[model samples]
Target: MLSPAGDDILIIMERLGPVQKKILLLFHGIAAIGLSYNPRQQIWILKQIGREWNKINQQALNRAIKSLYESKLIDIKESIDGATKITITQSGKTKSIEFKIDEMNIKKPKI
Candidate 1:
């Protein structure tokens, strides 16, 4: 797991469906955000991202999370508070960076 101090994500994007990609990105973002602060509190990145998604396709979010866990790109650890804890693996961060760079490199339409 890349701590809040790290910065990067990549190819995992290619293997993921759009929903999965979105979920992964959200985790990456949250992890980055939390690292800058000293407070150590559990944050549920998966559910937070899932809630931001379209309500009509909620099943898709669930499936995406299941896939991510199965692939070992992210972990959902048990918490004493009974809350979910999501963390992106190093592989996942590398893949997410790949996706972001690819997206940034896209040529814009000549309007």
Candidate 2:
């Protein structure tokens, strides 16, 4: 059973486009792998995300990132090396919880 928090996240996610959802979930996955947003690792991280979204164009990715940034769901920083570091904000973390809730499979007991 989903708690109120889980329900709330789902409602929020419904308003986001597919690219935005994937980006949010991708950040969550990156964190799960213990990877920090290092300038040197930015390309690798983006490459991985690109592989998962082979059908998505670069322009779409950029637009989605821009929208997420404008929404304050993520923070983007530019490193001296010109690489952008993206971090999920607290609101983004709350939104990302929808991934876990969606993955849960609760079965009903047969009477």
Q: Which candidate comes out best when scored by TM-score?
A: 2
Estimate TM-scores for all models: 0.60, 0.64
| Best-matching candidate per lDDT | 2
What tens-digit string does per-residue lDDT give for candidate 1 at 54-94?
A: 44277888899889888777888979989988888877776
Pick out the ten consecutive residues of candidate 1 with the lowest summed lDDT. 3-12
TM-score of 1: 0.60
Full-model lDDT for every candidate: 0.67, 0.78
lDDT of 1 at 69: 86
Give candidate 1's error at residue 29 in angstroms. Answer: 1.6
Instruction: Write down the RMSD of all candidates, one decimal each.
Output: 8.2, 6.8
Q: In candidate 1, residue 80 scores what lDDT?
A: 92
Question: Which ten residues in a row are the worst by lDDT in model 2?
Answer: 32-41
Model 2 agreement with the true structure over 1-111: per-residue lDDT tens digits: 657765765666777777887888888867755665566576676677668678667899899889889877899999999998899998888887756544879999999
